[model samples]
Target: MSGRPVVEVIDPGIQSTVQAWPGRTGLLAQGYFPSGPMDHLCFRASNVLVGNPPGAPALEIDKIAMSVAFLEDTQIALAGPEGIHARLNDVPVPIWETVRVRPGDVLRTANPGRPGYRLYLAVRGGLDVFEALGSAATSLITGIGGVEGRSLLRGDVLSALPRDPVSARRFPEALRPRFTTEWELEILAGPRSAPDFLTDQDWSELVSLPWRVDLNSDRVGTRLHPHRFRWANGGSIVTGGHPSNVLDDAYPVGGLLANGDVLTILGMDGNTSGGFAVIATVPHCALWKVGQVRPGRDTIRFRAVTYDEATALNRQVDFTIDPGRVQVL
Candidate 1:
């Protein structure tokens, strides 16, 4: 029905954008936000199912209820916090596994209002979109990559890069990350977790309690409620008015940043540097949990972990996402 193998957007869902693996890198120092997939495990698994190499461009959706039409034969897969409902040509299909489609085939996705969060869609070949700063990640912060650097809109067309098809596959059930509202994140001390600002007891309370997710949370930063820290300096700095204030510090992607009385979990599109103090940094392995969590409804508690332990956990996650571990269909 078309010339090049293409997918046409029928209804672009909210916050839906094209993303890729290992997003913009080595350039954050020069002011680029590394806007990649929110859920790395789900993103990676989708690519593997479709036989795409790492860095292949894929679609990311939040509260997905979108529709797209295929113009040719290709393979596709979906993955995320919880597999949402999808149908191909009005026939039910499943997530976390490869599905075949041909010309005139339409794929529609929607949530049942239960547990799904961020969802990813991958084609046999990655989507054909422009690259910015050597990446295809669409950073809404700067609007520099992917479909003119913005979330997808209806009538947008994406052609698949030239690639051969691969066999069908799915992620292993036992190895899948458990998506939940109450997230227990493993964190390590940050640069400003010292006694000069926050006391030892403050650090203890930060890790020991469940923090409420704030409605203000977004891709820039996830906000948390009730900043109940007993500051050693009485919320005062040499030139600051708030207890969490400190000199501008280089931002960490998963850092726990204090902004006034509200705490934030710095995200992919968050600030590169700021005046807030970062008391903890969530490890890469656990950051996916942050990406899938529901703001204004969910809660999170911190669990302190050493650097060595974090590294081990990352390795374990890597091993679990392997294609060999999932079912062969």
Candidate 2:
């Protein structure tokens, strides 16, 4: 605990946990993944609205009903997919904006239907926590950060680091994040494709067909499927039993990893090293789209992009998230 007590959880939504921005870095070799918010842009927007640093610890709600009681007066902000259900006590509260609260005020949210999956709630000061590996992000699979490295539970109390009072602010409406049923994501083709693995035809098909997000998808990875094509050279790589197995190699954080015919986009809690083959990498600029993907409803199409192009897109995204863009009220 690093500051004054601020809130108590009344309802812990599915997979809800404490998380911060840009999570633990330079420690992947220790088998710890940066279990930060699924949507970095949303995470930053929430923090900016409440006058907290971008990396301030906050609650990452997993698109389900949640409720919390304020233990003290403070300002808070919520951000996520465009149309979310939320409230302050009995009054409806706006999303992507800041709201002032008093002691005993209750903030609650309902399920975020198909539009998206995760939401962020940030206080005036970042949440108080003993940073594990230098972050407050939670790794549910390995019990790494967050409250004991697990999802939040009802009755949990939260504290916030002391910070100066900040006035109201909101993210622009035109710039808010949008969600759709289909997406065309760009990837840099292959650290493992080509004449040795994927033939020219195989490479063509990987990006041609639409892949649907599987229901089994989780924070660790977004599993995709169609089950229509067989790998042309999965057996060409080294293996223990499966054709897709290879000597364990550093896993590209947002790369397209293949285990047999199954395709997955490594996400926030995805592994750092694995024996599975990484065929293509989804650029960091485009990975936030992966966070909002709706299971069983969203479909993805891949396009090959150059590294320079990806970098340019990332810069564009950065501009959209700049603190100066916030509307002061």
Candidate 3:
């Protein structure tokens, strides 16, 4: 087998895209959204396992079922919730650890055995893709970065950066995230809520029940069922017809847009600004769970927290993954 450095996409499976650390930044005010990997925890873990610096560009596969042919020998790794079925040259491959791929070898991933939605694969030197807006992440909505800004399709080919050989490694089992159907996200009170836009009763109901994910969800955002909320003013003073509409303003990373009984959480590829009222915001640390939730199967609950607490959680998550060293960013 030749040691040439190329990968051929045999099948794109689902919404497979190239993602990197911190994605697109410093452009949200200009109507640009960061289109990086949905699950940062898994994405970073995969990169570290393959000897790439944390936040290195990698493949973020949605719903599994992708196939590729390696034209060169290299080291790779996969990281995500348990239950993914992956194989190299028809032999089963383990997740969370680095493995060697020989030239002309076929690598394929089947249905994920668990409930999560996104999975990550990282090569030793990171995938070679054009960087747009200082990132290689693909935004399906804007079509801006990473492989012409879309998911991988049949016949797609990717190049790997040249690097000195590195020893294979695995992340500690205790540090890996466990996948589950139920999720509890810690949220902070939104800017609009400070003026009492929502009543006390509304907040109680929001956290009291588990909400199912709608099938119509996408990279831009996902809708939750049974919104069960109204303006505190009892439907008076309509905010531009729909109860959710408000003056357009810059949106946060995880804006909770509400329109009467319907609610949608802004995701990594969400719009920069909108007319919807943001009822609450999910901190950066909890966003990984939002990306891994499966539509029509997963459910979510939000618990309110202070901004300080949210920031602390972010640091905690980072320390849990890579404690003793600074990220290369």
Which order, best to worst by TM-score? 1, 2, 3
Error of 1 at 202 (Å): 1.5
RMSD of candidates 1 onward, in order: 2.1, 1.8, 3.3
Clashes of each: 1, 0, 1
Query: On residues 164-278, what C-alpha lDDT tens digit does candidate 1 reach at each position?
Result: 7887888877787888778899998977785877899988889888998897777888899967678787655574888788777688888999887788998888888878888
Q: Predict model 2's lDDT versus the native.
A: 0.84
Give the per-residue lDDT digits (tens) of candidate 3, residues 119-210. Answer: 89888788888888788888888887778988899998888787776766767767777788999888888866644677777788777778
Poorest lDDT segment (10 consecutive residues) of candidate 1 = 1-10
Local accuracy by lDDT, each model: 0.84, 0.84, 0.81
After superposing candidate 1 on the true structure, give the runs of residues whose Cα lies further than 4 Å from its correct spot: 1-5, 235-237
Give the range where candidate 3 is weakest over 10 consecutive residues by summed lDDT. Answer: 320-329
Give candidate 2's error at residue 289 in angstroms. 1.2
Per-residue lDDT, model 2, residue 152, is 90
Q: lDDT at 160 for candidate 1?
A: 81
